[model samples]
Target chain A: MDNNKLQAKDFITIGIFTALLFVVEFACGILGFIHPYIVASYVIMIPIVGSVPMMLFYTKIEKFGMLSIMSVLLAIIMFVTGMGYLGAPLIIGAGVIADLIAKSGGYKSFKKTVLSHGVFCLWICANYFPVIVTADSYRKNLVDGGYSTEYCDNLFRAINSKTIAVLLILCFVFGVIGAFIGKAVVKKHFEKAGIV
Target chain B: MALKLDPRTKLFMIFIVSAVVMMSATTPLLWAVRITMTMIPIFLLIAEKHYAAALRFIVLYSAALLISFKFLSENSKGFLSAFLVGYCSIIVQFMPAVITAWYVVRTTKIGEFVSAMQKMHVPDGITISLAVVMRFFPTIKEEYSSIRDAMKMRGIMFGGGNVTDVVEYRMIPLLFSCVNIGDELSAAAVTRGLGGKVKRTSVQELKMGGADYMLILMFTAALVFFVVFKYMK
Candidate 1:
């Protein structure tokens, strides 16, 4: 593809991808089965899984500039939409970290792509650490307030019990699935279309 | 020259105002002060011929403040003070950041901002990510508008149904699309040379000028005073 045409395609891809991320996050929240924590987990994971397609597009099109632009854009959107006060900083920080990992692994290489997702997973895990602590505090508060042992037990069950464990496992499994999908889609479409 | 304050300066102002607002939540006087402080950037933006952008910021912040306050009030006792504190702190904390970011984007080119990050020893991955985020904002906004339009065409009534239904059914799709977009974009970034190892340079340079230094100092002083005053009680 000529340089101008390639640039236009890259821009369009970036636009589409940004919209896709927002939509997926919204859907996860709407599904009702996933709690806010799970949704937040998805938000953290999506970017990591995203590394695959990013590498594919850049490799084919040779327009590396979009990476930085997209990272900033995601952070701004999260912040403006009132995701959280820390949303912008976290997105920016995570994006940079993920990018560095991708860079170090040699962009588009299998090792680079897998490591990027791993790094993203670790970040998501770390982000939820505070929530775990908060839940523990709430549990203690319930106990101290003379709530029934059953109530306290249920509270713990709600957070650290079977449901949370199952959810976390699901997140990890889905993350892996996303990575694979990213790889397959990029390889099938962009490469075949000769748009890369 | 719009809102020509340095980012560091604005950051300091945010720090001070947030501290004071958080500390004296029930005091109407403090809330008034907080509101006035929040207005500084808005006024500056208006004076600098960026009134429309300033209004957009106001609307966004106000919506966030209202939602949070409503939720807090519904959920907690002694919520009045907490709500006041929460809203005041939000305005104080976020307005300056927004203003500073606007100034950064307007005065300096993206390339220059990247170079500035480089000079400050920010990692290449981070620098690139920051750039991507800046570029992504407008695109996402456009995407949101398009989705909203599509929903309207489909006769997805926004407010005519059960509130829970509207949020669950209508809003979810829009949000899902955003996450999907992020997934695609992240992949695209990796394919590009974003994570490359060469010592990268920018097309423009961000230099710290005297105005920036002065603004930083003033903001720092204000923050310190507010913190000390609040804590002394």
Candidate 2:
């Protein structure tokens, strides 16, 4: 394919992905399965999944410039769309780190992709830590305000312990699954699409 | 029609509202003002035809409020106050960002936005990764829907069974699928020369126009006013 045509195709793909992410996030939020920490995790994971097709496109088409373009766009959307201003910067940082890891692993290998996602997962843990700490403090404030100390204490414990455990499990399972899917799909689609 | 102002302006407005709301705890008046401020963003979202997005915000805020009220207070007095504080803080913090995002996505082409970022000195590899993720989000969603359909076809009723059973068997698998999609996305980014070291120039240049400057100034003024008002108490 011509370089221009390839660039256009990549743009379309990115737009579609962003829209999908918005829909999934909205659905999860409405279903009550999404909390602050989950939102953080989900946003961080997006680039990890997105990087595969991006790399494929770049490799095949030799249109390396497109990647930076996509990142800025994604960052702006995340920042401006109430994902939190910090989210955009954090994602940008995570993307940079993931990219470096990918490069260090010789970008062409599956190991690079998997490692990048793993790094993203670990980096996003910081986002969740604040919520846990805040919940703890809020609970303490409630106790001081003469709320049932036991109940507040229990809630705090639930959030700090059980909630964290569940989140960790989710991260591990999702990270591994995302890695496997990326490997399979990239090998199947991009290689055949004649883009890689 | 509600927020016709620039996104940068709206962002400033949110910052001012948030500062005022956070400064004085246990104040119904402050909470009400903050709540009313939050309504403006929702109105903007609706005006923009993003009703689903607006509804999502309402649900999230409502849940946060309920939790704060139920857990933070012993009496009705404290409950209402805590709820307002909790809810208003989130709205105040997030609303402007959402409104700004809506404006950007609606106004600028995605490519242009990405180009602007590159011009501003973001690394090439990082930029590419961000783009791919944004790009693949929709594809993943479609994939998820198809998977969900397949599961339904196989008689897997989503959210209709025993809570534990649904969580253990159904929800877990669905979440796992999302992870699988992420993996695919990463591999695609790597093969595309995302981490390559070639200096890149984007077609878009995010210049600070006069309007942007004016909005920033206004934001600064509002922030100052909020600070003064808080300390005066």
Candidate 3:
């Protein structure tokens, strides 16, 4: 029972990695302003860029709940940053599913880890929820809120309901690819340093 | 005077501001309410003696507001105008929540935050992880700067012109340091009796005061005013 329980150490690890992941997200998010297509590409950008810290995190995870807690944190942060609560369910859902997948692999199997990561990366799609679910109103809000019509048109073009399915698949595929790259990086650095 | 507020009140302020921020203000009156809501946090920052930050936020926000209102419109075309509009609108749209979040994070100590969370019956896992997250941002910034300095000394500018190198050079070092720091942080936490079986006690007792009540009332009023004016109208 004690072995299964999360400790202070686990919490700190989750906190550190969550912070790192957020930094990566914020950095990539800044570029979306340059072009709407960049916004749609967050799936590719975040998973690959964020995977290094995540893979390192995976190496440290010998228990469950870490990823789930991290997702809950991400949801709260997204809300606090004014991303709205629309995506909160998807974010938390992806986290729990990712946690279960990793657990099923006993947190050691490489195939399970990659698949778990792919599932976890779906949270990136949650950012598109407002755009898809409230398309008309959200577009109206943007135009009313000072965004250019061109920008809105492009945004909706790149990320409407139909394109979202493709984006989710891209996010998962890139997540799997990112996992392998992240594992290599971890092996190249952390494993050599005896930190893993 | 250093007007200390209860963490709960500050959190409520965050909640209200974020909620208001999510919904765009359409009418002038709604905008007025929104601007005023944003100002309260700036004033609170000033009251907290964060003079530099308050002044900086005021300048940036008002400048963005001026540029967006005076210069840009929906019909404004071209890349430069679009770029300016994008930047200005982003600042105008999200700055309020950002400022409020910054104020809350800057003012609230970790112990106070944790105790308040416990008082609210938050799970220990979430609370502890959240507290660490709150404490780790500044540390990351500090570590990042040091890494940048080291890179400069080696003359490894912008990952030697490779995009992957740009990411790899910075990210790998950052990850290593963060992992090490996490270990050290957990050790310190364990030494302090964190995750112990006994129910923990706090050194700083939390109590809501007049300021807390006043701020809560004001924020609630602002939220109510925003919603009613935006939707009911």
Candidate 4:
């Protein structure tokens, strides 16, 4: 078997980690309904929470395209769950770039993995794309879609076009931070257990 | 007869419903179209003998619609009302896509899904990975519940009040089991010739029957009606 080509095992690993990551995202998503600020804080919540599985995934990454495939799956899931396709480009873009970053490190260097995971985490901000891109129409749609005026106000206040830049930065920074935490936890638990 | 729709048709239904879901229904006519689109999946669920789920979804969706229409409005105030409105509105807005997706996931077998995707010429990586993902949600839920049960037995409630610990206690164990399961799964799949260089054949043969075409036509009509009405003023 050629070591360069991803096999059935690699795809299964990607699938498992993607499912785990989506579970984390769904859990954090339910919390966002309580407050729009919590919605804004998905940057902090998902990356930190989701990084555990992802770090484990990174350890299994011997070849390329795994991260990218995971991102495509994430985009498909986001659409199916009614999150819209406005974010597909950003999600896949981040995934491929993250893949390349990790590849440059031979998928082993800690610094590149951290940066790759950070780049990968930028996909979380894709949730806010519709809000930022079509500000007026989206607000109107929210109101028309039965969200109360106050909810729309708060949601918009917390996540408008201007705030998206900041949100993106926070997503990346916390992604870097979460990668370290994820790596440490993986080390503490999986490496000791020989799973890693 | 049991209404066994093609997986391709199911995928089309998901595509249409999600597109409609992205755009809000402004007028009563559009809302009617949207509601009809939503009901088709529930009806399919019922047809598939998922009566309990169908009933639950219907009751919850109707209740949310009634509350949103009668009590909550654009100007509903206060935190409790806001919370209520938020939940109800979310239900009203995303219920169709959720119901369709749920129906698809619950009713379709993994073999059929993979064969359908194969027929459509999707990449093997995405297809296999997505099939695993679709097949794994229930396993994850089962694993999570068992973990919760074990945690409860140990009196580790709420991770002793530390939020990170709460996350760590649950997540680490879940990951451990999932990785182990993935290993087992890949072994099983490879034994079944999953990654062979030759194209794999399936026991499940996919064909678009009458029901598939009919449902596809209905969904396409609904999507076109929605976009034209909502956008082309």
True contacts kept of 1: 0.01
Worst 10 residues of 1 chain B by lDDT: B18-27
Per-candidate DockQ versus the true complex? 0.08, 0.15, 0.68, 0.69
Q: Which stretches of candidate 3 lie over 4 Å from their true place?
A: A144-148, B72-74
Clashes of 1: 54
| lDDT (Cα, tens digit) per residue for candidate 4, span A14-117 | 99999999999999999987888899999999999998999999999989999999999999999999989999999999999999999999999999999999
Q: How many residue pairs clash in each candidate?
A: 54, 35, 0, 0
lDDT, each prediction: 0.50, 0.50, 0.90, 0.92
lDDT of 3 by residue, B1-233 (tens): 67999999999998999888878777779889989999999999999999999999999999998888765544657777777877787789899999999999999999999999999999999999989988999999999999999999999887368788989998889988888899899999999999999889999799999989998999898888888887886
Candidate 3 has a TM-score of 0.97
Docking quality category of candidate 2 according to DockQ thresholds = incorrect
Please report the interface RMSD of model 2 to 1 decimal. 8.9
Ranking by DockQ: 4, 3, 2, 1
In model 1 chain A, the worst 10-residue window by lDDT is A122-131
**Model 4 regions more than 4 Å off:** A142-148, B72-74
Give residue B118's error in model 3 in angstroms.
0.8
Tens digits of per-residue lDDT, candidate 1, A76-118, equal 5444432333434544555566567666656657666555554
lDDT, candidate 1, at B99: 58
> What is the lDDT, from 0 to 100, of the residue A62 in candidate 4?
86
